[model samples]
Target: MTIYVNGRFLTQPTSGVQRFAREILTALDRELCQSPALRDRLGPIEVLVPQKVEAPGWRRFGLRHVPGGRGHLWEQGALWRASRDGVLVSLGNSGPLLHRAHVLCLHDANLWEIPQAYSARYRLWHRALRPRLARRAAALLTVSRHSATALAAQLHLAEDRFRIVANSAGHMLRLPSAPGVPARYGLTPGGYFLSVGNRSPNKNLRALIAAHAACGSKVPPLVLVGGEVPGIATQATAGGGRIKMLGRVPDGDLRGLYEGASAFVFAALHEGFGIPPLEAMQLGVPVICACSGAMPEVLGDAPLWFDPNDKGDIARAMRAFAHLESGKRSAMVHSGQKQAQRYCWRESARVLAQAVAGVPYQLPAGKQAARGVFGSESRPVENLF
Candidate 1:
């Protein structure tokens, strides 16, 4: 079977979606290649990727040579043609062709929920493309049960059409705490709370900053890692001490920050599946996150929860995490570690391959014609094994 995976997201910085695409594809290529069940049922699998990506190491899953230009027109055309042979799976927002038997990994509906987080042009593009992509998809994949439910509710998609595959921590599972990292970032050792992610409006960073200031002297300094620092407003506080913005730290440094922090903080108003909190958990750091979207689903009772809308609530959560005794902190860390183990890339790949292999070749009404290069399934769409 030929599987064309949209690898565009892989080019982005290491984040939830990029990591998902890269890790899952790598795992599938390595593990599924030797699976007797997959081999016997699906025959030899052919994976297609963008041509510009290097194929020697880590890039070999599928690279194809599509012309690079404005608006991704050439790449989309290439994907459409390549997908003609068999099932196509898009790992991001964009889809390849109109009528192919395809699977779409719609990570979240963040654009619709928080339009202010994105620019007008981005929102317009999403509004135009998302519905068409969702309607055309043979099966929809999401990063969390929360995301699955949200997509179904927002897009009015049938429950059975969606598949929930949670995101997992990357291969760098753990990071040892380095003593001088705090000093390098001009922070006291074990005297700061860590927050990581892009500086988009949905991150609710302004609220976090307000909450951190409201905590007064009891809470440690707030260290924000990742995203470009906005030049418009001064992030520094009234006392000249501000939320330390360490924009886009290297992976090793990020791990150090996570390990050495008093607690990990996430203030996002929405997320498909929050991964940074899980990463912090693996690093033995206690987490404090907003009690909404996939945050509660991902963290459960493992992390300290606060309402994103209430600055006082966020401050309270921060103070609680900051003042917790060593024994209590240790317990939270252990619980978080156990919770983090629930997600894995290998299982994600297995389920994804199953979904793609099981999709019927016959295209549905208003959907594109499914080329019969692959055999049909005797079982119903809901009952495919």
Candidate 2:
């Protein structure tokens, strides 16, 4: 069987979905090269990406462009025609051909379910294209059970149409910061509460800033790691001293920020599954997260949970986290490490490989088979893995 993976997401920088795509593809490549069973069953994999973009390290495959340069016209028309020859799987939503037995990894239904959290353009795009994508996909893959339920409820997809493949901690997990690197960025060795991601409304940055202000002297300054300066300029703090926006740091530096932070904070209103919190957990950083959405699902009881809507509640949680004794902090770190262990890129790749290989993909009703696949079973799906 020829399996073509849409690699557009891998070309982008490290957002949650981009990270998910890159890691899974890398893992799949490694498995195919190293594992005899996977090599025999899957044959060779092909990655289809936008023209001119290169994935430097992937071994057995190379890049191919969809003909035509008409932008969205090309994605909707030309790519569909180009992808008709094989089983195409899109890492991001919106696969090309409707009739070609394609699998789509739909990260979230947030744009449809919680339109208020997104910008007008985003809402419009989701409204127009997402339903069509959901309807056309042969099977669906999502990062969490929450997302699966949301996709079924919002898009009216059958529960059996979707599967859950949780996100994994990156290659940086548990790795220590490079020596003296913090000094180069003018950061104190252990000075700030690290917050990664964009300043979009759904990320709840406004409330996070409010809570940071409310925390007074108890918490350290908040350090933001990614997003465009021009797009988020309006949200910048007045003095710009208390809030440090480092923009896009390289993967190595980001791991340093994760390792050396006083604590990691995430305030997103919703997520398909929160990856950064788990990233923090794997690094042994204490985490403070909002109670809503998939944050609780990802963090469990490991982090300090707060109501995202209430600035006062978030402030209280930060204050409590600030005063935690050494023993309590260690316990939180230990719990977070355990929680982070439940997810892995190799396992995620195996599940995706099975889906791509046509291994009787089925999604049973009401969490029966869903729980079995995504639940406490850490063992890889025997036949596929």
TM-score of every prediction relative to native = 0.87, 0.89
Can you tell me which runs of candidate 1 are displaced by over 4 Å? 33-51, 68-72, 97-99, 174-180, 228-240, 361-385
Model 2 segments beyond 4 Å from truth?
A: 97-99, 174-176, 229-239, 359-381
TM-score of 1: 0.87
Name the best candidate (by TM-score).
Answer: 2
lDDT of each: 0.73, 0.74
Write the residue-wise lDDT of candidate 2 on 26-52 in tens digits. 788877777676565665567766666
Model 1 over residues 280-369: C-alpha lDDT tens digits? 887778989899889888877899899999999999999888778999989999999888888887788778877776665446655543
Q: How far is candidate 2 from the true structure (C-alpha RMSD, Å)?
A: 5.8
Candidate 2 residue pairs in clash (backbone atoms < 3 Å): none
Per-structure clash totals for the candidates:
7, 0
